[model samples]
Target chain A: MKDDYKDKLDSLPVDIKLRAADRLKIHLMRQKYGYFSRLCLLMALIGPGILVMIADNDAGGVMTYAQTGSIFGIGFFIPFMIVMLPVAYIVQEMTVRLGAVTHRGHAEMIWKRYGKFWGAFSLIDLIIANVLTLITEFIGITIGMRVFGVPPLISSISAVLIIASIQLFLRYFAWEWISLSIAAFNLVFVPLVFFVPHLHWGAVARSFGTWHIKGGVSSLFIYVVLANLGTTIAPWMLFFQQSSVVDKGLTVKDIRDGQFDTFIGSVFMVIVAIAIILITAGTVYGLTQTPNLDIQTILSAISSKMGPLAMRLFALGLVEAGLIAAIAISASTSWAMGEAFGWPKSINMPPIEGWKFYLPGVISLLIAGGIVLIPNAPLGFLNLTVQVVATIFMPAAMMFLLLLLNDKEIMGEHINKHWQNISAFTIVGFLIIMNFMYGLTVVFPHILG
Target chain B: MIKYIDIIGFNGKRCDMKNNKKTSKDINLDEDWEDFIKEEGLIDYNKIPVQKAEIKGWVQIAFWFLRIYILVMIIMVIIGFSRIK
Candidate 1:
C-alpha cells in the first residue's frame, strides 16, 4: 500500500506534489497525535495572521501611537485602541477564510472573479501603496538606527541586506519564524512604559470611563482619530495576509487556528500600541509639553524624561517595527504581483527557480532604500504621498473585501452572518466618512472651522 | 499517451510539444487536472456573483466615491509636493 501511494505521488506534477507532500506531513502528524496535534497544527498555521497584525504596528504606526499619546495625553486613545482590537480582528479574520476557502490570494480573487478594470485598479493601488509604505519603513529604520549612532548609509544598506537576505534565502516557515523573533522586540515599548516616573495607574483606568474627547470634537481630534483608524487597517494588510495564508497552504479546516492567530496578534498590537501611548502620555504629555511631536521630537523627549535605557529600548522597538513591516510588505508585494500576473509564486521556491517572482519585491525594496539614502530626498512629501495614496485606495479595498466575504458561492457555509456584515459595514462606513473628512481638511484647510 | 498527459496539464495557453515527440515516460503522469480543480473548488470562482443587480447599487456608489477620492488625493499630493519644494 505504501509503495502504491508512492507510485501515485510520483505521477503527479511538481507543483501539486509539493502541495501534497506538505498536506501529507500535516495529515500524518495529526494521525499520530490525537488531541495534542492541535498545538502542532496551530504552530504550522500561525504565521499569516500574527505577522499581519504585528506588521500593522509598523514604524509609521508606532509614530502615530506615540503622537496620539503626546498630543492628546492618552485620555481618549487608550480606550479607543481597546475598541480597535475587535474591529481589527473582525476585518482580518475574514481574509483568513477567503484565503483558505479560495486557495487564491486576495489580488487573484479580485482579478479572476471581478474583471480586468477593478482588478487592475486594486493591483495598482496595492503596489503603489506598498512601495510608498516601504519607503516609510526604510525611513523609520534609518532614523531609529541614527538614534543609536549608526549613519544613514550604513543603516540603509544594512537594512536592505538584512531584509533581502530574509526574503531571498529563507522558505516560508523559516521566514515566518525569523520575522516573529524580530517582531517580539516590539514589546520593548511595553516595558519602557514602566520607566516613566510616577505614572498613575488610576489615571489610565479613569480614561476609559471619561471616554470623552479631550478638547471637544475639534478638527485635530478628528484627524488623530482618522489616523488611528487608518493605521489599524490598510490596503496592504488584506493582500498581505490573504496571500500569506495561501502561500502557507492553509485550508478550510485551518480557519479556527488562523482566527486564533489573528486574535492573539491583535491583542499584542493593541497592547504595544497602548504601551507607547502610556509612555508618551505619562512622560511627554504629562510634562504639559506639546510642541511639534513628530517621532524625532517624541524620541528626544523620551530620552530626556525616561533616560537613555528607555530611549534605547524605544529605538529598538522602532527598528523592529520597521524591519518586520518591511519584510512582510516586501513579501506581500511579490505575492500580489505573482498572483496578478500568473507567475509561479511561493517562498518555497528557491531564488534560482523563482527569480521572476522575487524580482519585483527586491527591486522595489532597493529603490526605497536608495531613496532613503539620498540626502534631503523630500521625505516629507514622500510621507504625504504614502498617506494620501493609502487614504484614496482604502474605500475601494474595503469594498472588495466586503464583496468577497459575502459571495455565497465562494464562501458557502462560511459566508458572513448578518451581524458580521453589519459590523463590517459599520467599520466601512466609519472609514469612508473619516476619509472624506480627512480629504476635505487637506483640500480646504478651514473646513475644520 | 502524450495526448493524455498534455490534456491533464493543459492550461489555457497552447501546449508546445513540437520539439519533443511523445515518449512513454510522459505517460507516467496521472491524476486528471479536472479532479484537482474540482477538489480545490477552482470552478466556483466563475460562479461568484460580481454583477448581481442587488449588489451593483452599493458597488457602483463605492466606485464613484473612490473615483472622486482618488482625484482629490492626487491634487493634494501635487500641492503637498510643491509646498515642500
Candidate 2:
C-alpha cells in the first residue's frame, strides 16, 4: 500500500507534490508545539486591525480626499498627514490593549466595566454611527458604479450582495484575507498621484515649507479641515477596532502584533489619504471651488485633464475603499452589538452560534443599499452630518479612552507614560477646543479669524 | 516553502513598516515598560484588589457616558442639521 501510494504521488505534478509536502510539514510542525509553531496560529489570526484602518478611509473618506486634492492641491496636509500617522496609531493602540485585557467590545467594556447608562449610550451611539457610516459606503459604491454607466439601483444591489456574501459565507481566516485583498487596492491613489500632468514637486514641497492654506481660516476651510479629521478618526473606528481585537482573539500576548498591525494600517491610511489630497491639490485646487465636487465631478475633471484611463482607475479606488469599509463597518456593528448583549460574536463561528451578531450587519447593509434608491436622499447633507456628529462625539470617546489607558489596574504594564499621557491629553484638549471653536464659529464666524 | 515573509506581509510602500520584523516589535508601546512595571501595583486607590466583576459604579458610569454621548450627538446633529438648509 505504501509503495502504491508512492507510485501515485510520484506520478503527480511536481508543483502539486511540493505543495502537498509543504502543507504536511506545516501540519506536522504545528502538531509539535512550541513558539516556532505559532507562525501557523499567527497566519490564522490576522485580519481585524487592517480592516479597521482601511475602513477608516471609507467611501466618504475617499470623496473627502478627492475633494481635498481638487481644492487644496497637497501642500501642508501632506505633512499634516505625517502627524496623522501617530494620531491614528496613538488612538487605535488603546483599543488593542483594551480588547486584549478586557476581552470585550468598546460598547460592552463601557457598559459592563463602567455601568448601564454609559453602556446603553455607547451602544446607541455605535449603532447609529455604524448605520450612518454604512450609508456613506453605499453612496460611494453607487456613485463609483455610475461612472461605469451602471445605474444606482444595479450598483447598490450588487454592492449589498457582495458585502453580504463575504460576511455570511466565510469563516474568520478566509474572511480576513479576502477583505485585506480589497484593502490593498486603496493604495491606488498613491500611484494615481504620479499620473497627474506637469505635477509640481517643487510647489508641493514649497507648500510644506509655507504651510499655506489657499486662504486663511474661513467657515468653509474649517469645515473642510474638520470634515477631514472626522473621516480620519470616526466613532466607528473605536467600536470597529476593539470589537475586531476581541473577535480576532488577540490576548495580551497578541496585543504586540495587533498594535503592529494597526500601526501599519494607520501608515497606509495616512499615505493614501495624502495621495488623494496631493493628486487633487495638485490638479483640482485653485482650478475650481465647488461644494458639489462629488466623485463624478472630480473624476470628470481628472479625466478631462489627465485621461479616461486615469479617471477609471480613480473610480476603481473609490469602489474598493467603499466596499472594504462597508465590510468592516457592518462587521463592527454586528460584533459590538453581539459583545454588548453577551451574544455569540465571531466571523469564525457558524451562524448557528452567532446569528444575532451576523444578522444586524446584513440587514443594515440592505437598508443602506436600499437608501441609494430613494429619490434625492440628500447625500451631501447626510455626509456632512456624519462628519459634524462624529467630531462632536470625539471628546467623550477620547475621555473614556484616556481614563481606561490610564487605569493601572486594567492596563498593567501598558499604562500611558508621561509623554503618551501628554500627547493624549494634548490631543483631547485640542479636539475639545476644536469642537468648541467649531460650535462658536458656527455661532459667530468673525470672532476667531 | 519557508516563505513566512510572503505569507504575512504588506505592500512595500516606504512608509509601510508593517512586516519589518525588528521595528514591528517596538510599535504601540504607550509607556515606559520598566517604570510601569515598578509603579502600577495590582490595587486601586482605596487599596482594594481590582477585580473585573467588581468594577466600581463611578468608573462604570464614566465609561457608559462615553458611549451614550455618541448616540445623543447623532440625534442632536440630525435634528440640528434638519433645522438648517
Candidate 3:
C-alpha cells in the first residue's frame, strides 16, 4: 500500500507532490505518536507563520521601527506595536483557514471567485508592490554591507546570487527551514535592547499608561503611523501566507496548528519590533540633534553611541532582515504569479521542471538588485513610494480578505466568527481612513494645517 | 454535449450535491469535465448554476464598494508617485 501510494505521488505534479509529502509527514507523525503528536504537528506546521511574520519585520520594517523610536521615543509606539500582535495574528489566521479549506492561494481564490476584474486588480497591485519592496530589501542589503566595507556592486551581486540559490535549490520544507534559520538572526535586535544606557522599565511601563504622542497630531506623526501600518499588514503578506499554507499542505484539520504557528510568529514579530524601537529609542532618540535621520545615519548613531560591536550587530540584523525577506518575497512573487496564471510552481521542483515558476521571482530580484546598484537612484523616494503604494492598496487587499473570510461557501464551518469579522472590518476601516489622510497630506501639503 | 443531469435525470441542481458515490475509474475518463461532474456531483448544466461562489445581496454591495475604493486608491497612488520627484 505504501509503495502504491509512493508511486501515485511520484506521478503527481511537482506542486502537488510537495504538498502530499507534507501531508504524509503530518499523517505519519500523528499515526505514530498519537499522544504527543501535537509537538510533532507544530514542528511541521511552524514555517509559514514564522516566516511571514518575521519577514514582515523586513529591512524596511526594521527601519520603520527604528525610525519610530528615534523620532517619537518608545512611549506610544511600543504599546502600539504590542497592540499590533493580535491584529497581525487575527488577520493572518484567516489566510490559514482560507488556504486549508479552499486548498488555493489568495490570487487563485480572488480570480476564480470574484471574476477577472478583481483578480487582475490584485495581481497588478501585488506585482508592483512586490517589485518595489524587493528594491528596498536590496537597498537594505547593500547599505548594511557597506557598513562592513563591502561595495554596492559586490553586495548586490552576492545578495542576488544567494537569494536566487535559496529559492532554486531547496524544496518547500527545506526552504522554509533555511529561511527560518536566517530569520532567527532578526532576534539580534532583541538582546541589543539591553545595551541601552539608563534604559528605564518605568518609562516603557509608563508609556502604556500614558499612550501619548510626543509631537502631538502632526503630519510626520501620521506619516510614521501609516508607515508602521504599511509594514505590519501589507498585501504581499496576505498572498504569501495563504499560498504558503497551501504549499505546506495544511488542511482544515491543521487549522489549530496553523493558528498556533501564527500566534508564535506574532509574539516573535512584536518582540523584535519592540526591541528595534528600544535600541533606537535608547541610543539615538534625544541624544541626536537631527530629527530626521535616514537609516544609514541611524546606524552611524548606534555605532557612535553604543560602540562598534553594537553597530556591527545592528548591521548584521539588517543583512539578515534583507536576506530573509528577499527569500520569502521572491517565493511569494513566484507563488502569486503561478496561481494567477495556473502554471506549475513549487520549490520542490527541480530547475528543469519549475524553471517557468522560478523565472519571474529571480528576474524580479535581479532587476531590483540592478536598480539598487545604479549610480544615482533616489532610494529615499523609492522607499517612500513603496510604502505609499502598499498603504494605498491595503484597503483593497483587506476588503477581499474580509469578503473571502465571510463567504459561507468557501469557508463553511470555518468562517469568521462575529468578533473576527468585527475586528477585521474595523482594521480595514482604519486603513481606509489612514490612506485617505495620507493621500490628502500627499496631495496638499498644507492639508493638515 | 450530453448533460450530466440528462444522464442522471436530475435537473435544476446547484452545488449542494457533495456525495462522491462514483470514482474516476468507474467513468473510465480522465477529462477535467468528467472529474468536475463526478467530484462535485454537478449533474445539472442546463441553468447557469453558481459553481462554488455565494455572493448574495449585501456581499455584492460590499464587493462593488471595494471596487470603487480600490479605484480611488489607485488614483491616489498615481498622484502620490507623480509628486515624488
**Over the stretch A1-449, how does candidate 1's per-residue lDDT look in tens digits?**
33444555456553344444454444433333234444655676687888899999999898888888887885889899999999999999999999998888888888877777778999998999898899989988988999899998999899989998889877666688999999888888887877788789898899999986767766677778988898899899999999888877777877898999999999999999999989988777745434236787778888888898888889888889999999999999999998888887777666876798899899989999999888878877777778777887877887888888888878889999899999999998888788777666666767767
Highest TM-score model number = 3
Q: Which has the higher DockQ value, candidate number 1 or candidate number 2?
A: 1
Candidate 1 is graded, for docking, as incorrect
How well does model 2 score by local distance difference test?
A: 0.70
Q: DockQ for each candidate?
A: 0.07, 0.07, 0.08
Clashing pairs in 3: none
**CA deviation > 4 Å runs, candidate 3:** A1-4, A287-292, B1-56, B78-85
> What tens digits encode model 2's per-residue C-alpha lDDT throughout B1-85?
2211121232222222222333322322233322322222111112222254454676567546645655555565555566676
RMSD of each: 8.7, 10.0, 9.2
Q: lDDT at A192 for candidate 3?
A: 88
Best by lDDT: 3
Q: Is the docking of candidate 2 incorrect, acceptable, medium or high quality?
A: incorrect
Predictions in order: chain A TM-score: 0.96, 0.89, 0.97
Query: What does the interface RMSD come to for each candidate?
Result: 13.8, 15.2, 15.3
